[model samples]
Target: MILILFFCFSFTVDQYIENGRPSADPVVVNPVMEEFDPTKKPEFIIKPRKQFADEGKVAKFKTSFEGVAQVNWERHGQLLQQNDKYKMYPALDFHYLEISSVTAEDAGSYTCIVSNDVGSDTASAVLEVFETFKPSPTPAPKKLELDVKLLDRDVLEGTQQVEFKCKFSNATTVYWLKDGRKLTENERRKMTFDGVFAMLIIKDISCLDIACYECVATSKRGEEVRTSCALTVKRDKQDCNDETGERSKAPEIVSVTPSDLSVKSGEAAMFTVNHTGDTEVKWYRGRREVEPDDRLIIDNKSGVGHFTIQNALPTDQGVYNVIVTNKWGNDSMLVRLHVEDTSIFDGRDVKISTENFEDFYILQDKVGKGRFGTVHKCIEKSSNRLWAAKIIKCKEKQKPDVRNEINIMNGLTHSKVLRLWDAYESPTGFIIVTEFVCGGELFERIVDDDFVLTESDCAHFMHQICEGVCYLHAKNIIHLDLKPENILCIAKSNNLIKIIDFGLARCLQPGDSIKVLFGTPDFIAPEVVNYDEISYATDLWSLGVICYVLLSGWAPFTGETDSETLVNVTQAKYDFDEDIFEDISELAKDFIQKLLVKNKDHRMTIQDCLKHEWLALDTVDGQIMKRLSTDKLKTFIARRKWQVPTPASSLKQSNGGGPSGKAFLNGGADHWHHSHHHRKGHMQTPRSSSYSNGQVPWKKNGNAIQAVNRMIGKFSSLSSNSSISSSSSSSPTSSSSLYSKSKQSS
Candidate 1:
């Protein structure tokens, strides 16, 4: 058996080439051998070389052999024949196979066989197909619609400005040209492209701007569409009468836009004028012609003129004019349009006619005071309207932050968020005017003697809070301090809540973060305590604390002191404690738990909280909500408030550089929670008695408010206690008077 196996191995070894290279075995004849016979055996003189081909290109493999009469070719062991795709060339010295339009599938080993009557010889070469990168025409929309509209005013001399707008549909790569020269964006020449539209605003127009301006929109396919406008810069020496088509007579205006117009921000505003005769009319913003398109529009025909502004913004406020010209003469009307901000505050249209702070009738005594200044209940003498004004001293250092807050408020608008009526600079300080919330703090309402906040009340209030907060988040405003004190009721009769006190608030850009450790200790997120990046999640954590306190009247993480509470927050050490959460629904606890997660990314978002089962009022019955136990919550709140002494420092004004805003007390420790069962009239007792009734053992200036405009690098967030005052005038001084007035108005 061993001898037979050895013989078989020797036979197999003789049939294969050693190392897969050319073999010179005695049985294989050599091409140089003079005794070689064409029918005896085949020998290779040239072996096939590896070939490479690009996709769609032709590829060829060839080899030469001696003593062979027949040549055959195969690919990957498959027999090949001459065809349209494959060509075979056989000669006495060479044999070859050709593949036309080579593809990826054509890539493989090609074997050439040279044979005689006696034996055969084989040589193989690899065919590799590669992809070629060729220049391709850019793909773009061919049928583009292009329109050019005047943006600002007509081009005048160097004094005025001009703007032209170009709009395109289904195109790309937009650029502008002036007098055939491509114009690049610069300080004076501005261009902006918003996918579908392109605008070119030119300031300081002169004779150089008199040439034609062209807007060209090009696609990657090298296709382009263009629109052009000729700007005729009229000098002061030019005859206005000639342009009007008359020598002496000029246009006479029968009517024009009002001297002043006002519109709320984010809304639309229109201006129209009634005039006589066919007069040439043009619109101008300051020295520049107001472009008739973009955000502004103008129509002058049939002796009437109309100017409309869509989505009026505060930046749109400017002095505008309409110049009417005719053969006889010309007349122009200057109109000033003011776009008021209605976001952070309300009643922006109510003009504060009085410039002096003292001009307002001090409607009541000071209701609340903080680091900013005293909260006042004042009435405008002319309108007798009520308002709440929080005055902050405008020292140079604080001016920028104060102005920033004003600017932020000016841009915000949400039902659940407070609105800024107006911000005025006074000799004493800056008066931030906001609508008076007569219902006072929701915390006060929850603990009121006769008012027990059923789960329904909590849900309603929480929904409103979510709605407002969602809007704020949409606008990129993060209310770093969200608590019961910051949440105010529209009025006693109206349970709607409005978020206030943006002192710690910040407007975030994408991927922004805060890390100054600035929130109430008990409600502060673990990330904040660890000095991690603060984000919108910080507000969510605070909201969780508010929900917990509102439902259970107990803090989830508050310790005896601020430091201890901060440690607990850092460790996320808190629990339902069974006893406190026994009456709270599982859904409510779930919502709070999700928000209170130590990991910010794991925390529930405002959108998620809004959809939580506890807040999903649409799916739940009103009866179920109303049936949720509030008696236990009420008892816990009252007992806790009376039990914990109002820290003198909590009521005392702190000059320290921390968040001196109102602290988020576990149970609204700043104010007393009156018994709901107390026998009283239709009017609820005011908070003024807390100071007089001895519930507050401290005065207003004893560091009572802890979070005061915390330092953030060079910037400071101006956090001051928001005073509950009247909405019509400025901040009223006393809450009792406002309550009385609110009851009468109701």
Candidate 2:
């Protein structure tokens, strides 16, 4: 009976639904979406697409949502889904902005968009950054000077607002001096405006007002400009409320930073201040008094006392107290100090922002560092973006070096060359901000390892690098330094390679012969060493060397020292070991031989190398020669031990500037690893019977080394214009996209 009633109820409900029983009133439904083509509507826009610092330090973004809907705030990219209600969020554009934290990393691209049932519009803006300035240079005083003329002795009694003023003509920033040391930003009762002058308003004066005081003045010129003055406050004897208590004896003078405060912990810190007082000055390590030993010398005239531990160690960390004694009173200052390794990086002073390791943060771990400073990973602090930071320490005499790198990088826009996103200068070093490549160095991959790069793969990678270098050469820029260590490679899909590292590069000026032998000897062309006359061809020689090394696993020439290498170079030694060769293609062998020619004039140019049948060979995939051009090798290996060609002589000039490490002209050797040769005896040159008239004895054992050496020497004598004018390449295409689009070298 219950089952039957349930079926009856269900049937009654179904009948009611068929009879159109209303639940909430009938809703109107659109038969169709009216043809409101958003693309056909007037483009919506947000004003002030970027955030602007409209008020002091505050930034504002003005937005206008004007496309058929009343825009509401979209909380985290969500639209209000209620029917018949236009609940949309306000869009942010470049000009109009929503306020967020103006962090150092907040400097990035921001976008805003407006949308309705009919249409939507979008806009973007870049965030420009600025910093809030603070007092840069801090000052410390040696003594307090009093101006009796400026004193108001008439206001002499207790609890009176007596004011003290110290004036200096050269001071832009002034700090209240407590005792002898200048007050810091953390000190109490200090206030200032634009870092001009600090005023300490001591509400009520008492017997203690007789204390000595100093005022330190610091110029805005940062760390260099500073001055100080000292003064004494006086009052009647009755102001000495200490009269009611047992008075202690006054103390003597203690040491200061510049004077008595001098320090020599391996190297002295640039920052220091002076110290002085009344009673006998005695240094103490906490409760233990330090005898005035030889290491603790104090000069009364300078009020400076230099202190050094007999042997500084962990036990030296403690509270140092200086007891000053005089007839009036005994004053003591206890300074808590902790000393560790002096070389500890003190980054706080520079105010460099390096926090994240994602998208442009600083790599503080410092994997390795050199003359250019340090290299580390960087992440964007705000967005957590990652980058590589090359911290180049500024040479005091060559401050413009950093700016030169920045200028060059800022103008470069290439996909193969690492892109520079940002740069900044800190008090510590010049930060070269670049995109991070995780693929490591190419030498560490295929060439340095057992893995091999097929001819086409090699061509693909080399072609890209050549393209980038050619672009630079056309701009008259010569990469003074090029080597495996500096070349970076990464595959986008297991095949792409990118060459980087322009640290030692310089612009090739008109009539500017390379006057400095900066590159390593193995890669250094003959002319670069002998006459310091380098052109784009010098870099070309290095590129050839790179290619040869990659395929052959060794340089063309090698020796135990730079001298032997130079001699070999002079002899024009070609196949030092032909027996060590693998079954490589004759085309490949020919191309390598052409590029490695002892004469720079005869070396195959980049274009010629690319066009060579060796590079045109099909890849391992059996693709056609044309299709093989795009193949990239993805393997990675590392070469830690660099082989630098030893110079012919290590002799110092008779004038005597010490032993010479720099080589103006080196020969007879080139960098080669130990395993470059096959097992057993050195390989002999394969053939020489065809070309030589037998006059030069061109074949093996016919002074082949001497002939090659002379060829290199001849190259050193030839001028650049005379040599490159006959070079085999002259493509003028400036951009890759343009080249592909036109399929022509303009």
Candidate 3:
């Protein structure tokens, strides 16, 4: 048995050696089995760690695994793909995920999944996104102050040269004027400025050069400081005697053109005097001599004297006098200059009266109150006609806005638009006179229990509104704030309506697009909420909301909160409730539908609205006329009154909140209601007992006033940073997308 076992072991050993021996011809083996291991799995060699990134910055995650594996990326269990926003790279042992233009929504836990047939492993890291820093509000510029005044100078008639000097502070440029005409550098005249000092030198001075000399300094902010001095030229006795015993006689006036001149603002006005004189003439406005600036010119020739005003302003309206002297008797003639009010298209300056408002009209009881001013009913002293006067405090910061409104109102001539009679600027404030609207707001009329409103009536009102809007659109003007509160009737019994309040209106030029952060919450367009380019369709959207409210007593986009309402507007998430819209005709629904489209290009134009079949429909389905119930409208108005938040609440909400929260806190529901009731040209309701007795009640709620003031302040602050005009094409963005972008850039 031992011999047999030894022989078997020796054979086995010889067989093993034969099988394991190296040879020039290599023995083949199973390559997969040689490298494979049953217990092997993916193990992280370098795991991603927690990272922090600023919004709008790039974020990257990297990992390396020891075993062969396929790599994938996920955020909160949702698989991520390589697209414009995301990118992924995989190698044999390394993987990478990169996100571009990171936003607040990208902040979360990111996972890198590695898997193979054997097993799988995941490495997660938290990504913290932070907002970029925002710039602080710019402070108001300092007012330019004048420090010195020009002094009078005397020179001989044949003096070789004369110089006038003046000093000023905060002046960016200085201009020299003679008899109200701007001076230019020539052979005989020279002007020089050395920092704070301005000088004017005239060579070969003659009698004609003897007139009022003015030094006008202007700052970069357009603030002007003016000073004047008279230049008296002493004549030689021999020239006056003229080699005779009798002295030279003064010129005699023959004729004067335009003895009393009347011209519109921004128009050119000229007064020519035909006289027999050998000397020069000087012009004067009141006691002060008229200075020839860029817009005023004075000329004296062989036999005539002319005074011309170019682009006349309201302040230029006055009595002008011209005097001619030839060393003998002097002749003088006076002419009155009147400048009529012009539109913004004609001139930026509005004709404002320095006279007291009470001088022209008898101030009566207070009729209304607003965020910036108070309204009063007045009677024209000359015509005994009734009018409404809006009095606003003349704060330096608000003057431009008030003047802009006046200019816009002056430009409008349509009967359906509010008419501006006059405007007065006083020491303390401004008083604007407009047509008296006693019929109250459209909502007030709708709420009246005895008032009957039919679908046809709604159409008639809409027709008038469309006509007004069409006229405005033709002029490139868009009334951004169009609502029931802005529509006023001529009389309680008539259907005639007038649109008011141009504070939010804009005149868009070709290829102009503006983005502003202001509007009534219930009527704001989706573009407004998304901070996209605003166009004429913005007004059409408001019209659609107005029509919707008229037909159904509820707001289409109203929600429990302002932010929610904004979200609804951006998504166009409103439906026609059966209870409120069942009685409405299909054509009417179509009209509103066309106007309320989210894409501005798809919205109906003003001309289309005017020509729509619904406005021309006399009867619906050839049936009896249907009257809408006022109960819902009354409820809506009541709800609006209570929706205004107190100032304290707005302040609390604005503090320590996110971007959306702060925006809503500043210009959301509270601002909408406040602006609705307190806008310029708002009419008081006649339902109040005080109004019935010819004494309109001045309602003053402490909380309401405080809230309105706060709203106005908020508007001023935001307006400084809002309304950006861009040349880039506009693309529609959802509310959530805008929110994320705002967070990333705030």
Q: Identify the runs in model 2 with alpha carbons over 4 angstroms from their true place.
A: 1-365, 447-452, 491-493, 509-512, 619-746
What tens digits encode model 2's per-residue C-alpha lDDT throughout 1-746? 55554454355334323334321211111011233233343244434455544223434445543323323323235532322221112222212234444555545555554545555565556666665566787776333322221222223324545455544444566566543445554322344534433444443554343333445555444433333222222233222337667544333333333322222221222212244443355555433456532122233323444444421223344445454544564443344344454421122122234443234454543433332354565445654444456665543433454565555555555545655666766665567666554444565455433444555666666777777777677666777556555566542113445556554466776645343333455565665444334566767777876776655556665444443444455454657245433434566567666765656777776667657776656643343232211112122111114223222222221122121111211111122100011112433221211214321222111112122223345445434322201100011100111101110111
Best by TM-score: 3
Q: TM-score, each model?
A: 0.41, 0.37, 0.43
Error of 1 at 518 (Å): 1.7
Worst 10 residues of 3 by lDDT: 727-736
* Model 2 global lDDT (CA atoms, 0 to 1): 0.42
Q: State the lDDT at 370 in candidate 3.
A: 41
How many pairs collide in each candidate, listed in order? 73, 100, 8
Residues 710-741, candidate 3, lDDT per residue (tens digit)?
A: 22232333332231111110100001111111
Residue 716 of model 3, lDDT score: 34
Evaluate residue 614 in candidate 3 and report its C-alpha lDDT on the 0 to 100 scale: 96
* Tens-digit lDDT string for candidate 1 (1-746): 55554454355334433544313321222233243455567767889999999999999887766663456778888878656788765422345577999988999898977776777878889999997777797764467667655332444467545668777777777888765578998878899899788888888876445555678888756778877665655444334455656445345556665657887764556777776557788876644676653235587778888887654556567656676766544556556678887642333443333386676545454555543465665554654445566666545554555665666677565767877666677555577776665566687676666675676677778889989989999888887667665777765534767788766566776745444334445566776555456778878988988888887777878665544555577668678878756655677778888988888999888998887878864334334445345565566445543554333223321122221323222233332111111122333333222323222221333334222112121012223232210011011111222221232222
Assess the local accuracy of residue 727 in candidate 2 as a C-alpha lDDT between 0 and 100.
9
